[model samples]
Target: MMSQAAVRQPINVMIVEDDNVTRKYLAAAIQSEPALQLVASFDSVQPALAWLVSTPVDLLLTDLGLPDGSGVDVIRACVGRWPDCGILVITMSSDEDSVLACIEAGAAGYVLKDAGHLDIVRALMDLHSGGSPISPLIARKVLGRMRDAMPASSAPASNADARSLLTRREAAILNLIARGDSYGEVARTLSVSVGTVQTHVKNIYGKLSVHSRGEAVFEAQRRGLLRMATLKAREPG
Candidate 1:
């Protein structure tokens, strides 16, 4: 296992924004960051999706309003081709539906296009570090939606209710993933194969009604299915 103090590699990043100015700004910001390397920049969804087939990037920054198609498609393509890649959406849209759709499609972060270059770069860094950096407005909207989805009269779910949603092993896997462990890291920690971790991930996603790690974590937390303290207590030192 790599020590926490080990030097980290530069994060390879891809950009998919239709607006020329925004795309260039994003590219420049990424290029300026010493820890990040700009791999590919695209002005549309199709080209971005096409390029993803051959090149695997560590992070993807995309805008939702593309001339050819929605950025959600690009997010989905990246998620399918590179499950470990971090996806961040930079867009003007902050509607609940758009935010939920992007989250459901596998985006880990969502920032408004109006963010400064430094802010954008910081968001990318956060996403790469397994933090979901979302615009305040977008975050509020998402939280409001989640709250509305739950029954107003319902009390906090019991541990038994949480356990029923996932097997013990599945919960352990989900806990690790929610804390940002990649499949390989989770496999090594659990003494299982990467393929086995992936199969568990698929089952977790299906049972949680989510398509990505971020969404799975969000849904599980909302459903009161995750006990972070308990999970951490069980982690091997």
Candidate 2:
């Protein structure tokens, strides 16, 4: 059993969900936990990112779809800024592509929106303990992708053209976006402010010479960077 002292430090959390009702529900659920604190909440990626620059939190929970951008962007930004922080993608998307994208963007967990409060609580606890909590269906898809990629006799090497255009981090973020997370989620996963994520994205755009999310994703794919399933399979345990 955990000691009293261990339980005293509340786990700070930020919530980013576009839906007002769902966001309120999530906030209430998180607030109910004695060990968790809802530090901030936002309905869009831009404002959330703006807040993160000044306020730091231990966990970030977000949805894939937002008014401004994808939640993958948030995850990348978070991971970039606060690599130690935990990120959870709490969304309705169960598509393999979206699930794989969240993981690639550095989310520590993926809980389906339909999951009950208990399931979300379990995911939070798991994340706190350094576990990667993914829904069963997501896990199976990731495993299948891994198995499929393992037999490649000789995978194509990253081309110099692509390598020269994007920095390692930018490339990674692009890959995550292609998979479908929001910018606020990316920021939390990366541990950086939303502005920083935006900067990297802007840099990615400038370097790749592309504008807009779809264009960036397509370009990254053409350059062999949108391999979400492959990347997730290779992530360290």
Candidate 3:
């Protein structure tokens, strides 16, 4: 008897976009990928919320703007009912408040509508793999907000000791990541393999006691570990 090839399961994806053309485009793009399955799609908030009541999904891709109401409600619902499901926001909104609201409402990833279809797909994949995918521009804004939110009191002297835990290479990798470079892009910039970049990131996460990229960045910023100079925006490739 011949051994059988292992079959991989497709990720179940749900989409909620009020625009008909955009909805179809998103659905088609998702369907084009063999690793993703279009489980359900909604044009507004209510239907998406109603569908979530009985159905379970691996990922929820939603727009912030809806004809009836905000998509944040749907994100919150998924977080409440299906806590394990990863939520990704795809929207045209790049304002600080909108980005912060989605992040506060339990969204794992946020990408602008201007991102290529492949970029959106890659973001979903990253979310599936325990990564938080945030667009470069949105990332800068988030970091800026974090910097501004810092208390007037200086950080403890112990923060420097804690910062020293990261190796030079690890710090370099973290800097690149904070600038919104993907693992692959970081690898290319550092002339290393993607796996190597991921390993360093994993170590950075451990040292920072964070589970995701956003948390790592936030914690690093809080500890005064990041070089603000390196955080200047770079044009996303």
Q: How accurate locally, in lDDT, is each candidate? A: 0.78, 0.70, 0.84
Please write out the lDDT profile of model 2 over residues 1-237, one tens digit for every residue: 999977688889899999999888888888888888999999999988887777777989999999899999988888887777889888888787887687778776776776444356656765665444555445445444554554343234555556677777787776555444456556687787767777788788777786445445545655555555734653435
Q: Candidate 3 residues 52-100, lDDT tens each?
A: 9999999999999899999999999999999999989999999888877
TM-score result, candidate 1: 0.66
| Per-residue lDDT value at 196 in model 1 | 87
- Where does candidate 1 stray beyond 4 Å? 1-8, 115-118, 156-217, 224-237
**Candidate 1 CA-lDDT value:** 0.78
Q: With candidate 1 superimposed using the best TM-score fit, by how many Å does residue 231's alpha carbon deviate from the native?
A: 25
RMSD from true fold, candidate 3: 2.7
Q: What TM-scores do the predictions have?
A: 0.66, 0.60, 0.87
Q: How many backbone clashes are present in model 1?
A: 0
Q: Across residues 1-237, which tens digit of lDDT does each residue of candidate 1 receive?
A: 887547677799999988888788888888888989998999998889889998999999998988988999999999999999999988888788888899888888777775444367777876776556665445445554675687755526454576697988899988776654556667899999877888888899898787666687668767766655644453334
